[model samples]
Target chain A: MAVRDWEAVIGLEVHAHLKTRTKMFCRCELEYGAPENTRTCPVCLAHPGALPVPNERAIEQTIKLGLALDCGIAARAIFARKNYFYPDLPKGYQISQYEAPLAGRGRFRLPRPDGDREIGIVRAHLEEDAAKTVHAGGATGRSVGADYSLVDFNRGGTPLVEIVTEPDLRSAEEAVWFLRLLRQTIVELGISDAEMEKGTLRADVNVSVRRRGEEGYRPRWEIKNMNSFTFVGRAIEAAIRQQVAAHEAGEPVEQSTYDYDADTDRLTVHRSKEEADDYRYFPEPDLVPVEPPAELVERLRAELPERPADRIRRIEPAVGFDAAVELVTTGRDRLYDRLVAAGAEARVAANAVMNEVAAAGIDPEAVDAGELAKVLGARERLPRDVYLEAVARSADPGFAAAPFLEQEAVSDASALEPVVEAVLAANPEQVQTYLGGKEGVLGYLVGQVMRETRGKADPRVVNRLLREKLRA
Target chain B: MAIDREQLLHVAHLARLELRDEEVERLGAQLNDILAAVSKVSELDLSEVPPTSHPLDVVNVFGADVPHESLPLEEALANAPEREGSAFRVPPAGS
Candidate 1:
């Protein structure tokens, strides 16, 4: 198949569990790894004569995320009942947003190597999560080939926000980068834990392929419930290949849902018999519409923190774009900024933080920026061993640089002349090789001088002395 | 605006109801009568009024983000038709 002739249009529907203490529309406490059915109440258990009440913190958090992404907060948000049937959904329906979502029509700037691309946000709505199902007596202990399943309602009714993106991504790599940036943004906003491993963050990837200049859309396939970024990328790639191959064979691409197996690297069509597309959505009468006060919207917008894209932009010129992206997303940019404010050079401080400080397993927050800045400033003057040890212990409460700073490398030329002469006499062959125009041998002579002084002698001075003596 | 036999059967199937052939015909007519009664509101030309989901004008009803005690495990599982340990047991998904 001529894959180059086709382009893949990809989108993502990301669902993140909110960090509220209670469930979305119930009073039961949100707890993970609790005993089965221990966290359920009458409201969440769908008992008769029970009324659902929305959690205020969940709504506020969702709005804060929307404001951070530059979305328009709806004057009135409506919750609608999405009708469905399954044991996991005890209410036989999920209360999700239909026509009026809490947030709408935002754009997220995704930083790419070529340039920054804008991914359109269709909407971000609030919903409740379903229970956890543990399939038993299955071949692989999964839902496939299972004899029976058990339901744990502890996670049921958890508040979730579904953020849908427009089909703006053209490649799987772009999709992954967008997710990474999105996760960072969510986490920095303090809305959710957003841990994909813990199942707090999940995604549904939609993909379709069209000719390079095609105007209309092709039938898209939805890969459901992906938890890993790597798997999302691979699944989209696989979908593109399958659709392109169908086009090459002059067959039409059918719209359907699929399940991707990361282990086997295969996509199997999920045969859903319940008319999965027919949700029959209608307004939920049990709950009232959510109208965020204008004052509240203004307050949240004003309190929004510096976004990841803006943070990357601020630090890009100093450390370049890639390093800026790395530092900001990993949450070490604040410490780097503080160090720079404490009079440490930007590039030196960044290198020490990313390389030495990270390698020593020091929490950047634990280290006092002033102390670390001093240590970084003294790096060239101190020996290699001393400098690394200072960085490792920089997080200690009683850390001081005066003791470590005293073991400065001997840079005096006369003091290192004898050591350089002894090294040159001992290694006559190397000295001859150096004089015979093999310039690389000068490094070996410098090493001998450094070892003689036990790493206290400055390598730069030793090199200058060795080169001068070798030439004579 | 009227319900037909095939549509009635489809709705019944979606709701997991077992309807005999005679019941389908009877329910079809009854559903059409109910629709005809409800469709009378569409005749009015009150385009200025907005649609509403609830009878009351209340909006933004919420509870504080606080934890409350959940029912005991045994009491929570009291009404389950089938049980396994502390969880509710059911047939395999999509069975």
Candidate 2:
């Protein structure tokens, strides 16, 4: 097939949960993965006469996030009722930012470990989440074609921040980088737990393939529910193929929504019944406009943490960390602070966190991270034995590390010599293997020595002793 | 000029509107009146006024890109009208 000259112009609409205690317009808890619908209330459920009041925390966090994104704060913002209905929406109309969003055009700077590529932000607005619905009598038994689907209002009332990006992404990798950096920006801003799989972070991908250098833009399809970056990459690739295929088939690429099928790994059409419309947005009429003080916006700006891109430059030197910048970029600032707080040697701690804790690819915030502050601030109060114990239990925590360290204390570094020598004597045959150039044989000898010493002797001593003995 | 029943119903469908026939007829007439009045904004000498998409000048409030805990796939899709695996499945276009 003759490959047509096409470029996939991608934009994103990412909805993230604000790390607030309440929902966007109600008092319901802003939690996820709780018992379905447990985080709902009459106001969030949209019962009649329930006048929605904006959650202040969500607003403030939204402001802080806007500041971090470098968005020019709106002189005034407002909440409007987006009149729409779905099984998940308890309210016939969702209270959202139609005319006056909490924030406006902001720029997110994503430091491509590869280079200095700053992604542009179109806008980041705060809004309320919709209720959730489960279908029956469908594919996967979720919507199995029953008379009705199950509805959960747990997320319905949650405070959400919707970030729409300009179509500046030239490649899927850039798009993914932008999304990752956006999450890092928000996390550092303390705005939200940007988890894509948890719906705290969700992406609606707008992909339009044009002739590589063509202008005016082609009709694009919006891909929804891409939960993982890996899947996002696949979905983009699939969409590109579909677009090229459609164009080759002489089909007019229609403007519509499509979904990435993880099963088939293909892009399928969603709604083609209507083209994108002028939302006819106007100043909302119900609630008062959210006129945040211009001074407050400035205060937020003054309080802004050094940008993540800058932090990587400043702290990477101080932390002397070595790894892909992306690994540390998301949680690096907080992770570094936590290490300093834990009183662990900053470089050492940064190494473990960057490679071990964060490399697990889990959110360090989600873990019991209070230890970081404890380790940094109170490590002196904790006996050196306790410090040793903490690192020992990295893989497990049932055994108290301090007592174990105390009981297995070595009589200083030299005490390791006799144990190492004894182990060498017992494993003389293995010593021959080490001399024979099987360096792994030395590991067996080291373990034998540690076992013989009841793990009381330091392993480094054992290693030195074994090395000396084998060389002899 | 009054908006017709068919056009009203069509707009409603595009907006995912589920309105009764009589309500559609009523909305058709009301929308026409509103549009007729709002058309004056287009007639105004406002070409120099910069159009604004957002009232607030704030931008770039991003979250950490790290993946947080997600609901089990079933839980995420449990509320969908149709679902396959972790995805919410909708009925075939006509169904």
Candidate 3:
């Protein structure tokens, strides 16, 4: 697995089964865990003479993704048969796109913990999925002595959007973030559930490693069996490391499809390039070119929802406090929208949503952020006794956020500044202990005076005033 | 030149097409003719025409995320050639 005098280049082809109700090309319900092969039909099961009619919902879903990803619409898409013979494929050829994909040259921006990074989304295309097959035994599924195999059509015929990424990926962590962001975007767009654990989403990572300061990249080995984001990232790292060793040792790495062993976390050769060319592509003649009208595309584009990245950025500055905005921005936008819809100021709602509601798992719909937000934002219109109650327990968030005004005292501390100075000038006993950083005695003195002030003085102002006076 | 019979058989086997010798011999000549006929496209000034990936703009459009009913066991297993209860059994492999 050595790659000499080269750099590692990585690209990904991720297929996401849009959580749709029906198969992409048929009316068969796309419900999972149905009795195996029960959802099959002439069109879905690929019976001869059964032509695949495009699903309107599938088309619209793909278009919505294109819009969210900021990709141009493909007005005419020709479906070609990727000619391949396999036990899983009922039809000798799979209907897919080659010359014209649904959308291409798209880009997506991933939100990191600190900043946003842009990744090139090469293209998003439409294609029918093949049935599921269980290869028996070993890590290869067919590697060991096998007795038999199983087949499940429950997952078959699900419409998948194949998102191809540019080979611009550098590190494994970045790739993981990119996948997470993509999944998040799809979920936010309501386009796909994109659960990789459930096989609703899957990724194929292509990796090639080269030497440091090399001009050309090494012959990459395509890594497969990466079912999860962490797995994909780990596989890429392992592949790069393996190739780097090969390069350092002046050995060349061959182009191959390697399997990522999640248990031991290493790359094993699944099949070499010579053996991997079973995917014989040919134009599918039975399925005609899908040419949805241009006006339909226009309508979909017009109805496109604002992507999360765009929507989040616009909402951040609307709050006067940046932290409030930032905190709320991390949450589900639907919840935020509901809060705003329920007569909450975006800013106060943002704060209450982040600070108060998030900590508690109350069904947001049951207790909308608006009710608590109104109390916090409209304290002037609220009862004074309620505000006072909020001031009393300012130390405890649960106390302050008990659906009450959270403000406490600033007037008393400043008013007590002169009195505390006079007291300090007269005594000078507790001053040294306070100056020695054991300022706990200063609170005792301030509390005694504040109690004398009949709680009329602000406790915070009193504490500050007493502390300054004691300092002298 | 006559189509090479051995070369055609090799390709057919790789593609997993179980072809009779006569059918293979005929398809070999026919495919070469088709390829030779369509090779004229390369001679044309078609470099200016950018390839169209999809004619429609719908790639990511989705509906209100909701669930529907799955097929009943009997209905789901109706078409299976070999089924016990709700499962479809396949021919045993590696025998």
Candidate 4:
């Protein structure tokens, strides 16, 4: 059976840690590289007789993200206890939303090769992160071989918003594109850093493959704790191939959890279906149900920033599709917009930003929009090399392009005549070829003139002058 | 709606409790009685009444996002059953 004969259905659950001053329930400061257990508190450590109080700022941030995603915010949402036993979870049960999530039924659009496609978002709910468990004396430093483990409670109570998507994705490329847009949105809203390397943003992907016209979904296998987007794409492709092979061999694809080994490009079963724990969920008795006020919701909605898709649509006409995508995906569209507002030509500004600023490794925020506009506005007068050089130097503070601006290329026919005459005399063979109906050799004479003047002579004027001189 | 001995043992296992045969049989009956008592509320036709997860009528009870002083190292590790250098030592963790 060929690969295209089967359809792969993929869904993702992205967990982004909220950027707040303190932990979700406790007042312990949220520090990334702090010493182990330095941020622990009685509530976060799950000491007996300690109760949790909700953090208002975390709730507001979650609602802000939900609004940005166009999700329906739940007026009355309650946290439930997800019961399990793990060394990382000091409390036997984690406070999460099982039935009443904070937001639901949203749709996010991804720019696909075949236009844009909307991916359904099942829910985006708030939950507390678990502690970090470090296993030592193992080959992989994981819990596979001999050694005890140490627990770090500092990261235990950090606030996280888990965004779960419906099984609307069809290919691995689409999944990665959706994640990129989602990360951009989260970072734009100042919710989370969404840096996968720092462990703030992570995902667990569920994949299943069936025939093209299949109705319902088959039992899906979940790949857990994928930290990098590149690894996520590889894992999805590997899982689909594995499932398709199983179907071809008359073997069943069991519903289970698997861990993807990036080094080996293999999926190893972590836990079977029978071993899956029944997270006996119940409402958390300590925290009260969250009912956001109507006025608060409305205020947040009104203050929401423009969505990325809408920003792309507004700029796509001025800039081409590739430049528009580059601007929006890199989170530099705001800078581009500012340059446009400052009287810079949209198409020129887009090219300068995507080519010059990006290539110089200069931070977009560090570059002044007004200075960039001045440099790009003079693009027509300056040669391409000089224009690019000005764009690169615009990152320096208090630097103006006008001070170092070059004169316009020599376009006047009378001024360019001598240079054309010299080039026609030097490249006599090329001029002869041109007179013999080899019209392409005119470009060679034009290049020789521009090279003689150090790229200061306009090629268009040189072409006309050289044509008349050589014909004579 | 009857609680069997197998179900009782499963719940005990989930809660990390050991039970004998007689204890399982005895607890099964008690659980059944408690379920029966709670089942009476299900019989009421309170269709319009929204299910309440909390007894309080309040909502949005939260603290400000301000950092406060955490407990000292000694105090933070005071309640741990075992401890290592600046961390709590637990048994071998399963993946």
Interface RMSD of each: 1.1, 10.0, 6.2, 1.8
lDDT of 4 at A202: 97
| Model 4 per-residue lDDT at A167 | 94
Where does candidate 1 chain A have its weakest 10-residue lDDT segment? A270-279
* Residues A1-472 of candidate 2: C-alpha lDDT, one tens digit per residue: 3445777888988888888766666665555576765565556655568666666667778888888877877777766666644656766666778656777887766555455665678777887777776656556543323444656666786778888888878778788877876777777777777887776788889988877677878888888767888887788888888888888788888888887888998987773433454344454444566778777778878888777666666565565433436435645456556556656666666665665565455455543344543443434444455454454343343333344434444646576777777777877788888888889887788788768876655666678777886777
Reference-based lDDT, residue A280, model 2: 40
The candidate maximizing lDDT is 1
What DockQ does model 2 achieve?
0.07
Task: Write out the backbone clash pairs for model 1.
Answer: none
Ordering by TM-score: 1, 4, 3, 2
Write candidate 3's Cα lDDT for B1-95 as tens digits: 34487768767776758998789878988988987887877788988987544454434323333333445557655666765445554543322
Q: Is candidate 1 or candidate 4 better by DockQ?
A: 1
Q: Name the top TM-score candidate.
A: 1
In model 4 chain A, the worst 10-residue window by lDDT is A270-279
How well is each residue in A1-472 modelled by candidate 3, as lDDT tens digits? 4343445677888888876788877767877676566676666666668776666677777877887787877776666777666556767667777777878788887555465667788888888787876655445566234444566666667788988898877678778767776777787667788888888888899888655686776688887646888888889888888878876777878887888888988898874323335556654555555566787778877876666565656665665434433543464445556667767677656655565555554444445444444455654444455543443333233432444533323374445666666666655677777787887887767766656655545656677677565555
Candidate 2 CAPRI grade: incorrect
- Model 4 spans with C-alpha error above 4 angstroms: A138-140, A271-274, A342-345, A366-371, A398-401, A404-406, A416-472
**Residue-level error in angstroms, candidate 4, position A175:** 0.4
DockQ of 4: 0.67
Against the true structure, what is each candidate's TM-score?
0.90, 0.66, 0.72, 0.89
Clashing pairs in 4: none
TM-score of chain B of each: 0.93, 0.60, 0.62, 0.92
Model 3 misplaced regions, further than 4 Å = A1-8, A111-117, A136-144, A271-275, A278-280, A311-355, A363-403, A406-472, B1-7, B18-85, B91-95
Q: Is the docking of candidate 1 incorrect, acceptable, medium or high quality?
A: medium
List the DockQ of the predictions in order.
0.76, 0.07, 0.23, 0.67
